[model samples]
Target: METVKLYVIVFDSTHSAIAAETMLKEENIANEVIPTPREITASCGLSIRFNIDSLDKVKNILKQGSVSVNGVYKLERRLNEKQVEKLM
Candidate 1:
């Protein structure tokens, strides 16, 4: 199974979050704006998740647009839950 990491980026406003989403999509970078997790307090309560490898590109995109990123976090997830269950 492929190991994956989730990078969450918080925005200062819903408009910024939404605009960021659009810009990311336009540039063909994989990302989605989701409800902020309970672990973080943010201005708009919205966050975008992307792969760690793609963070540099994402940062450049945000910078070009003057988007304010409030915070970022890394989360780990197992990619093969079904395989693990079979072993059990």
Candidate 2:
């Protein structure tokens, strides 16, 4: 098995999250709109998940789109355990 580092972009609202998803798709940035993980709490229920490697590009895109991001987190999952660390 391989371990991967993923980033979660939390938004202040559902509309912002959805809008960010659309903007990212148009920008060719790969991401998924997933339920906010239990380890993290935010104002919204949805979050954008992407690889840690794309953090810089994702930030740039969100900035350009004027998206309101509540927070950015790094998530690690191993076997039955998961850990979340706030990055921004």
TM-score of each: 0.73, 0.85
lDDT of 2 by residue, 1-88 (tens): 5666678999999999999999989988889999988788765889999877788988888777888999889988887778888877
**Worst 10-residue stretch by lDDT in candidate 1?**
79-88
Per-residue C-alpha lDDT of model 1 across residues 1-88, encoded as one tens digit per residue? 6755568778888888888889999999998778976556645899887766877888788878877777667655565331111100
Cα displacement (angstroms), candidate 1, residue 67, comes to 1.8
Candidate 2 yields a Cα-based lDDT of 0.86
| Candidate 1 wrong stretches, greater than 4 Å | 1-4, 76-88
State how far residue 82 of model 1 sits from its true place (Å). 23
- Runs in model 2 deviating more than 4 A are 1-4
Q: Top model by TM-score, which number?
A: 2
**Residue 55 CA displacement from its true place in model 2, Å:** 1.2
